[model samples]
Target: MKIFNLFIFLFFVTTLSNAQEAKQDFYKRSFIAYEGCEDSKDLERCYEISFHEFLAKHINRKALKDSIFFEAKKDTITVSASILYDENGKVVKRHSRISNPASNRIEGLEYLLDSIPTVKPVLDKKNNGVALSTRKLFGFYLNKAKDTIVPIFGYTPSEVPYEIIEKVPVYKGCDESMSNEDLKNCMNDKVVQLISENFRTNLAIKHNLKPGIQRIYVMFKIDKKGRVKDIVARGPHPEIEKEAIRVIKKIPRLKKPGYQRGKPVIVPFSIPIVFAVSD
Candidate 1:
């Protein structure tokens, strides 16, 4: 009996060790692949895959789901959290911003976040492990008939390279209640509309400008306070460049500032405006 029991214990220990090593290998390969990605879109995609893999390996999803289903009484609740990681990928801090008025639900989410295991740090383009902030949204919907809760999760990088913010700065008049993806679309449409309505195409005609598509590139930053500034424009004609800058400067204060680790941060954006003129 003693020999059999010893054999069982040895098997269990070996199995656990192998599992840990496999997980570490997975993380290392994911980060290496992400670092090697060349295109911006490919890099973004790799970052997302690596992030979700990290969450899958480190988070106690089943426990978290149970806690939300059993503890939250609200029919629908949205919980947003900013998770800060150190150079070693250890969670340094976590802050939850719950839109629901229920204190119990908020507390439940806080507890779950606190219980998360240390994650493996992701490598940036520099090949260095740097501190980073990531955001997660947890949505819970209660089904009365089924006596269950349906949970949804969304993840985004809160801090990224200045040129690749996951959520761009939203314009003042855009719908604030929309999801992050929808808000981006709305902002793009609104900016194009503003430029089309205000731009002096008649100037091109008056100047006897060549009939073609004139492209203008503009880069600007929305400051931490939701104000637009640092407008720069380049175009084929000086007048076109001036008009682009003027229209961009006319943008009002944004509805909400960009965020990194629960704090507002300056967000930079670049867009190209193309004008078509026919003689």
Candidate 2:
């Protein structure tokens, strides 16, 4: 009995380790696939990147809603949703279960689930497309006044797999007529040019900063209205960080917002800027 139990434990451990490794490999492969294809001028590659980006942004954003809490009188509610995707990657079926159900609240949850964008089928080891399913949980709580619903927590069973956008957000004056991949490259080139033009390179010399390649990380969100917001930057020096933020804030409104399933959605973007300086 001891020997058998030991074998079972070892098997479980091995299986768990293998699963973890496989998950990591999948992410690595996904990153490589995106990076490899992102710059290609091919339409198919551009479309693939755009499709994945839309899926990632749309599904994650629409999966939770606080409005449902406002419609319900209940102090708390929990909902579970299952989304079924067809081989073609469209949502063919959806079902939801509400605990402590109220008619209005249930209706709201149902509507939200139905609005989820059509899923894209993931490829199997054989490179064959297969249907997929995912489950999500949403919790809502009533505010102190009990007059409005507030979303307390939203959870999805699996991380939504999304690739970095094949096309970066388009800036004003950048040619939009180019292919998606070319458009992204153009946007990047323009941003770099703007940074080079606007960045206070003299600040480094004044501060006696060492000569090296300085990297700044910036994060921002493009809202459904096509406006940039929540710009944040961090870098090796305060001057660099400040200048990065200032330049990013000056970005003009996008001609169009990112869309998923034909609906506009908020897309968060992050980029790293490297500046080379010489003594």
Candidate 3:
């Protein structure tokens, strides 16, 4: 009787999981098209290119000059904002939120998103207009020595290069007194150890992956608060990618966040998980 009851419980759990998955599939993200991206086969890529072009054309350089921090801080500043598209394709800047607190100090970005021109309405799989959300990140490195600014743009503001960070984030239990290079190596080693212990190496066998080397590329950010955020993974199989993300999210908050020019800043890290599958 106990065995029968256990079977029933597992059956119920499986049924519930499948139901939830179905619901998620029904509400999956829809394709979004910017003005120039309307007929592009790769809408996402096209939209990014078009959006960057728009920013380059519309961003007010004069307003940026007004920000005192830009001239004084001599550090890289990154700002991110959400862009919302209603069912009818209208930009609702008022409803969008600026994510970073430092964004408030940049005069140029205050109204930068408000100038977003209308884009083609997004439609769901059923051809019904649906609301969509997108994000943009603007960054500029202030070269105090050169007395100039270098502009950078990407999908996320926290996607800063690892080599560019002056101080890499410190993993728990790692000595903070180590040199910057040593600290970086220590943190990476710890993270890799965590992944190896937690990631299910048997996934390749279960998924029937080809008998060869397989790699999963993962990217995430250690935010200014020293907590892991924005985990993304890509692999041959969805299950493998999901497992990679799970292991990454299990990392504990660090002893200290990364620093640049004496100020805490977001640090982006990417790692590849490679394994060999047997025949």
Candidate topping TM-score: 3
lDDT of 2 by residue, 208-233 (tens): 66566666788777777778898888
lDDT of 3 by residue, 1-279 (tens): 011000000000000011112343453334567887777877766776676666545645564455544444537765454567777778776656443334335345556667777777656557677766664455656565554555555433444445545466788989998866567667777876787677777776677787666778887888889999999989889998998889889999999998755677787776777766655
lDDT score, candidate 1:
0.52
**Model 1, 199-243: lDDT tens per residue?**
666666665556666667887877878888899989777886787
Clashing pairs in 3: none
The whole-model lDDT of each prediction reads: 0.52, 0.47, 0.63
Give the 10-residue window scoring lowest on summed lDDT in candidate 3: 4-13
Name model 3 segments beyond 4 Å from true: 1-159
Query: Per lDDT, what order, best first?
Result: 3, 1, 2
Q: Which candidate is the best by lDDT?
A: 3
Each candidate structure's TM-score, on Cα atoms with residue i matched to residue i, is 0.44, 0.43, 0.46
